[model samples]
Target: MRWWDVEALMPLERELFGDTAWSAEMFWSELSHPETRWYVVAENPETTDVLGYAGLLAPGLEADVQTVAVAPHAQGQGIGRGLLDALIHQARERAATSLLLEVRADNEAAIKLYSARGFERIAIRRRYYQPGDIDAWVMRLRPLT
Candidate 1:
């Protein structure tokens, strides 16, 4: 995603993730390192409002999904899947053998999405999410080939 999109994405990000939402500087930092990072945003065609955003980090043979968020009103419309597919394609392009992501344990929809996309739960990080003290499921998709 471009620097311009950060502003447009803030409201949605805050609304969806609340205390866990990323700061503007975080997005700027990620975008500054385009060589190892990829971020994308989906927008409404008419109003050009941000519908969702996702990011990936591929520094070596293993790539990680940094984040994936869809506007609540736009959920279940395949935007998340499309964004995820983009990350997978980018991981393959970077020659990554595995893709990893951490999802909140209570996020059944997201877990199902990742599972359907070939990611398997490898472990769980206790109290990985702050405030709510939620657990995080560590998932991995290997053999990118």
Candidate 2:
């Protein structure tokens, strides 16, 4: 992801993730991190407006999907799926044997998306989220490699 995109993504991050949204600086740092792999701004192919973004961090054979979000107005347009597909592809290419991520248990939409992508719940982190004290579902997907 480029530095220019961080400004645009920050608003969407706040809208979708509320208190969990990462700051622009965090995005910039991740973009430059050696272990971070990010795919940002999927264009319309014709119009070329950025539709979504996804990120992953692979420190070793295990990878963690740090975040994935699509524009609020662009939801349900398959942009999320495309971004997720790219993340999984990158993980495989990086020789990551397993992919991991934590999702708010209350976020059914996100849970469904991850499950459809073959991430199975392996554990639960009780009270993992603040304010509401919600649980986080820890999910993992094994790569074919």
lDDT of 2 by residue, 20-83 (tens): 7889888888888755565556656787566677888977799989888887778888888888
Instruction: Give me the overall lDDT of model 1.
Output: 0.95
Sliding window of 10 residues with minimal summed lDDT for model 2: 34-43
Judge candidate 2 at residue 67 and give its lDDT: 87
**Which lDDT value does model 2 have at 126?**
99
Clashing residue pairs for model 2: none
The best candidate by lDDT is 1
Q: Give the CA lDDT, 0 to 100, for residue 94 in model 1.
A: 89
* TM-score, predicted candidate 2 vs. hidden true structure: 0.90
RMSD of 2: 1.8
TM-scores of the candidates in the order shown: 0.98, 0.90
* Model 1: CA > 4 A from native: none
Go through the candidates in order and give the C-alpha RMSD of each one to the true structure: 0.7, 1.8
Quote the positional error of residue 72 for candidate 2 in Å: 2.2
